[model samples]
Target: MRVLTSTLLVEAVTELSRGTRLVRAKEVLAWCDRNQVDCQGAGLKNQALWDADLEEAGGPHRLLKFKSGECKQSRVGWALIAHGAKAREAAAHLGWRELRWTGENWDWLGGEPPPPPRRPASREAPAQAAAVRG
Candidate 1:
């Protein structure tokens, strides 16, 4: 099985928030647990696992964005996606275009193109940069 990171799941939901789907919180929680996510301190405080939210939108009744911690956020977005929450609206809120789910894996549909490939320095740039900085 291709294990998914919590970040990926969150990003996927953010991407898929345009299809009017309502995903349950429990489903997301279950997926996180199965994927060995360390959510013990990842927020999600008192909300029930069964709570449903529109895939990617943000509101009190839906996927409310909470300050998980210093520069971190919760995976509540996954719950929203699993429940088939509104994808387009949610994607708008998340600044994504579309979402894609294959009943197991989720990903962005139409968003920023992937990052450029990394190329190893010819054993020169790194040393030169370091030397220049030093």
Candidate 2:
């Protein structure tokens, strides 16, 4: 089984987004299958793929059906707001807000925490300069 990295998936999604129409998860899955991209080793299953689609874009803007045909849609992930680390950090930094799986929408957390405090200036250099001046 070939291992597919999240980076490759991100690239595929980015490329797909450039087209006029919204790309379906199944379509992306088919592309990956044709290319022999395996998810088994990567710990990503069909469910995870579905989750990714929801996270990236709130769906039935896209869809996912199991071989069994069980499916649902909602707003998912922070993909619309930000991708990858930035998205994760945004979710983390925003205190009360959670990136929810709405099946058709991404709900941003309402409140955001203040940015981290800046460090103080170097005391050692200032002290040394004071001594030299004296």
Candidate 3:
């Protein structure tokens, strides 16, 4: 059976709109079938897909599933959220706030946590540094 590698996962997510698009359970099943992956009932049996803490190479983001059962029974499917985005953000995006969200699972996609965005230094910093040096 084909394993769900980071590349396939990333491609699937990217092709599906990077989490902005809501994928159905059947579509996910089709992906597995097309890739020659084995499914456990209606869900994938791949460890990489089920592991909540799986680290893989891609971007500074995550690929997660909103699981309601042991499988992909839930209509809500997957999303790719920023690594630093809060659990609530994921929960909200997947519309699981009022549903069975306890088993939400995720994989650590992306290589390094991206460098923090740089902000311009304050106008007074150079003057202060020069005075201190003097």
Candidate 4:
């Protein structure tokens, strides 16, 4: 049980995507497998989760535009990864949590919480960098 984070999701999609090409659901599932994450439950659902902006959901970039008959049965339709919804006012609906599509709805994925965000390595400590700047 590993809690999925937006940062990790972004990294996965970035690594999986080619220039101007969106990552497909299958490729993302493969990534989860290679990374040892728990996402297999998602495949049992009607809609596929994508790593794109939720704002894109109602816009022209909708991933559902490509669904097959098997995918067209759900009201959930599809969901944009939580990370993609984090920057907007509408984000309140998505929240920041360890979520997974459990074939029926979004719920806790149940794993250790994500690690704290890391800072880039610096030649000087923060106080030293500030002292030098001053």
Compare the candidates by TM-score and give the number of the best one: 3
Cα lDDT of model 1 by residue, 1-134, tens digit: 33344444564345444443433344455655766643333346522221222222322323332211121232233335344335445534544334344344334454342333356769888899999999
Please write out the lDDT profile of model 3 over residues 36-102, one tens digit for every residue: 7543424545445533223332233355544332324444345555432444355455444212222
- The local distance difference test score of model 3 is 0.47
**TM-score for each predicted model, relative to the true structure:** 0.25, 0.34, 0.39, 0.32
What do the candidate models score in CA lDDT, each in turn? 0.40, 0.44, 0.47, 0.40
User: For model 1, what is the error of residue 96's alpha carbon versus the real structure, in angstroms, after optimal superposition?
Assistant: 22
lDDT of 2 by residue, 2-78 (tens): 55545545555555545512334555676577778754443545654544444444433322111111123322222
- Model 3 ranges off by over 4 Å: 18-20, 38-48, 56-60, 68-76, 82-94, 97-134
List the candidate 4 regions with Cα displacement exceeding 4 Å.
Answer: 40-134
The local distance difference test score of model 4 is: 0.40
Name the lDDT value of residue 123 in candidate 1.
Answer: 85
TM-score of 2: 0.34
Candidate 2 local Cα displacement, residue 66, angstroms: 17
Candidate 4 clash total? 0
How would you encode candidate 4's per-residue C-alpha lDDT over 1-134 as one tens digit per residue?
Answer: 54234444545566664432334446666676788655532544412234232324334432321221223341122223432333222222323223343344434333432333356988778879799999
Backbone steric clashes in candidate 1, count: 22
Lowest-sum lDDT 10-residue window in model 4: 62-71
The positional error of residue 82 in candidate 2, measured at the CA in angstroms, is 8.5
